[model samples]
Target: MTNPADVKVAVVGAGGKMGTRVSNNFAKSDYQASYVETSPAAAERVKDAGRELTDLETAVSGADVIVLAVPDIALGPVTETIAPMLQQGSIVITLDPAAAYAGLLKTIDGVAYLCAHPCHPSVFLERTSPEQWADTFGGQAAPQEVVAARQSGTDAQQALGDEVIRCMYGPVIDVHWVTVKQLAQLEPTLVETVGCMVGQFLKDVMDHAINEVGIPEPAVKAIFYGHVYIALTNALRGSNPFSDACLLAMDYGREAVIKDDWARIWDDEDLDRVLAKMLRLEKIER
Candidate 1:
């Protein structure tokens, strides 16, 4: 395993969103880090953050780990450009699994590829500080979990990837290792498709309640926010038995709002279909 403090790390899109976050963490760590950005505005952000920017070739060459923190659409070309220059046994990490799972990354025979996505602090995480409570996205003050996939690597290479994953997305609690396909399924399929969609739908319902039903905005927010917490706890954890009336209402709501075939989204074909749309591909190739 690579020593965390001695590893040479490079951030390819150091001026972007995920890039900035991971770069900030690395800046505060002991690892030797290089920040590379192509955009003028983003390059300014990186320099303004007190990070010295390096050229792509200079940053990637001989690096122990190279992080492609660019957008999913650019990952293919970015990897194609940089993968061949990497040192042997070096790990290339992406912040998301979509590009890797959809066969969008350029692979090198001796170079390892890994993808790690932050689980973003759970809603149920118990917090003791204002900072933790305010850091809803994790990687700042709150502790969070990470789901990662090592597409090509030995156990030691995987360990090195995990070590860097923890540093980049630090204050981390655990790292759950899974296959690239499994990671993709948990992301766009389970989380974005169902979980995030439901969260937004609830917001739309609340807006409708206030605007169309003429409910007072303050009163609607008060009840809806509290009920959202209760609903999640009861449904997810069975924290307490829900009342019979509540259960009956839930059943009615589910029947009215959800199709019986919604579970098909979990199927392998459906996963590929959604992933294709996400990656802007005609179809995923194996």
Candidate 2:
């Protein structure tokens, strides 16, 4: 086992959103960590956090893991520059799977490529403190799961990669291993496309009800919030059998709101299409 003290981890673009979140945990960890950023604004943020920023080359030198915490669109050019400079057996960790799955990340024979995304704090989390309640995004107080993929390199490299992953995303409950393609699918397809879209759609319709339909806002929200929990528990957990009338209403709602061929989002072509749009690329090649 590689000791955490011996592991040299460098976070590139160390002042961005995801960068700052993970850097907070790494700062409290035993791993020797380096922060790197080129933008003056970001570099100042790093400095304000009392972390000395290292230049890209100095930070990547002999580093066991180089975390590219930059944006998805920047991954191709960023990896093109950094991947070849990595020492043998180093692992490159990306926070998102889009670029890695789309083949935008550069490849090197001896270096491992990994993508790890946090699942965030669950709605069902058993929170007992103000801190946990405030940490809806996890990594601070609330425990969360992670989904990760190792795209290359040996078992030892992966083990160390796992350690770094758990460290940076501390308070993590579990790390579910999946293929790079599977990780990509879980993200934009399952979570963003379906889950987030549904959430936003709910808010939109709620607004329509209160504003256009002339329903009382307090009454609508009172019924909606409570029913939301019951609906999820009944459908997802089978906590209680939905009344027969409720089932008919649900069936009608499904037919009215959901398309018959909505499952086509699972198709690989559709995944590639969405990934391209998300990454602002012409198309994902493969």
Best by lDDT: 1
lDDT of 2: 0.91
Local accuracy of candidate 2 as per-residue lDDT tens digits, 1-286: 6788988999999999988988999999889999999899999999999999998998897688999999999999998998657898889999999998998888899899989999998888899999999998999998999999988878888788888888888798988989999999999999999999988988999999999999999999999999988888887888999999999999999999899999999999999999999999899986
TM-score of each: 0.98, 0.97
lDDT per residue (tens digit) for residues 1-286 in model 1: 5666789999999999999999999999899999999999999999999999999999999589999999998999999999768999899999999999889899998888999999999999999899999999889999999999989988888998999999999999999999998999999898999999999999999999999999999999999999999999988999988999999999999999999999999998998898889888899887
Model 2 clash pairs?
Answer: none
- Give model 1's clash tally: 0
Please give the distance, in angstroms, between residue 120's alpha carbon in candidate 2 and its true position after superposition: 0.8
RMSD of each: 1.0, 1.1
Quote the lDDT for 26 in model 1: 96
Overall lDDT per candidate, in order of appearance? 0.93, 0.91
